[model samples]
Target: MTPSPILDLAGLTLEVNHLGRGVRFYSQVLGLELRRHDEAAGVAEFTVNPHQTLTLWQPITRQANDERLAPLRPRGASHLHYAWQIDPAQLEPSKALLDAHGLEWQEINLGTDDRPDPTLYFFDPFGHGLELRGVNRDDARQPHFPPTPVQRPAHALPVMGLREVALAFGDYAAMKERLPRAYGFAYAKEQEDRDFAQFTLGPQAEPDGNGTPRRWLYAWDPQVGLADMLGGDHALVRFYADVDAVAGQVDAAGLLSVRDEQGLAVRDPEGHVFEFVPA
Candidate 1:
């Protein structure tokens, strides 16, 4: 029998203290298109990829007597880090653009083979670490690259949307063994060093529907501080799955999971939460 399919990474919701600041940074600095923003609802959504959405929501505290007025309060993850894919040709221009804006960025080699995929890591105005990975030339074992472009700042590098997200953990061995088996996601690539080990996850077959490739990176590092800086109780990565079969798949996998109104919630070895929502 064939296994249930985990179609695509449809959404990644991030909590932000200030919705306006988050919007400005992602729209201006990162060059993502602003899809919609509801001030009353306290949420702003952006088109990170073709069909992929990244939402920034601010917490609003309301008083009983003065119900009409609410103040912006701190909520969501503070220092969560995620990477956006950029054309390899734009690597130098991206560096130049960051320098022109007086933003400080650091470079690192994260490729498995000799030629490293050069990545530029920097923080947004709201303190969220954003990475621009030059993976145009890097070959994928299960290749799925689509040419999706967005209106960006003048002379700024165009973002191809989110390519990978890193989930840090204290325990590695157990998560490394179980996640792939449970989710039906294939191991695409991996790279490691003294500090941490990073493994990429993808579907066995090339994904369909607005099908841009995405990577689920499981990172293991014990001595690393600030691993939880960007994410907290509300920081979530939500995937769009076939609702009919997903629950059955989860049950068949025989993994311990909690089923709530939001769908199935599963935790990694070190307690990183992920939810599979109905598509």
Candidate 2:
């Protein structure tokens, strides 16, 4: 197999129906530092982990053609799902924090039979499903990636980093053929049946060992997400990869692509928007 130039999943964008409520939930409730907020454009950015971001943009229907985000305005995916890695030491504490905020959540093990990764499932105010998977700091795929600096009660649910973004595909075959071809992701070590497949990317630190990649794009059945339709018109996933090479692969595969100063953007058969920028 050829090497995938995907350095990392730089950011994931989710559409928020209400910018104020979304901002409050992420900043006040989740404790993520509000790095930037463009009130005019209704866009907010939150810092995640050592080098990642969680962006919420409430697209302005009338002025959706803003130059900065033209063609693909800041609109994000709805009812889409993603996961954040958190310190296992704070599992119960995370649950308690959710309770304190009156946020209902459920726990499930999302690991192998031998390895158990306790995960908490919950929803943000905009109905975006989120997960707080219990993880050890050392379990970071990249050892250089250290444990997150804790901040006691204020930042109780310290998210180690963004781990996975799950999407429901109306047509899995086309995605399986194009995603890896354009971005160079590979099938996971094992299969969770045939209908669902996860493409792994970034830092293969222990590819030959039990270590898992930090970036995961899960393509699964439609029943998991409500907004899942034949085309995913609401989400945008961007990555730090070899944009030129990715663009080449994308074109070679006969997929439609649009390039700009920042990077390349492409829409898949499912209406999923993906952007590739220089790493």
Instruction: State TM-scores per candidate.
Output: 0.71, 0.85
Name every residue pair that clashes in candidate 2.
76-234, 77-234, 77-235
Each model's total of backbone clashes? 3, 3
RMSD in angstroms, all models?
6.5, 3.6
Question: What lDDT tens digits, residue by residue, belong to model 1 across residues 97-199?
Answer: 8887678888766564565566778877766677776654334333333435566778455777676555555455665666555665445434445434443
- What candidate 1 gets wrong by more than 4 Å, as runs, is 1-4, 61-76, 111-114, 137-147, 187-199, 205-214, 221-234, 240-245, 252-273, 277-279
**Which candidate has the highest lDDT of all?**
2
Instruction: Locate the minimum summed-lDDT window of 10 residues in model 2.
Output: 204-213
Task: Report the error of model 1 at residue 184, Å.
Answer: 3.2
RMSD of 1: 6.5
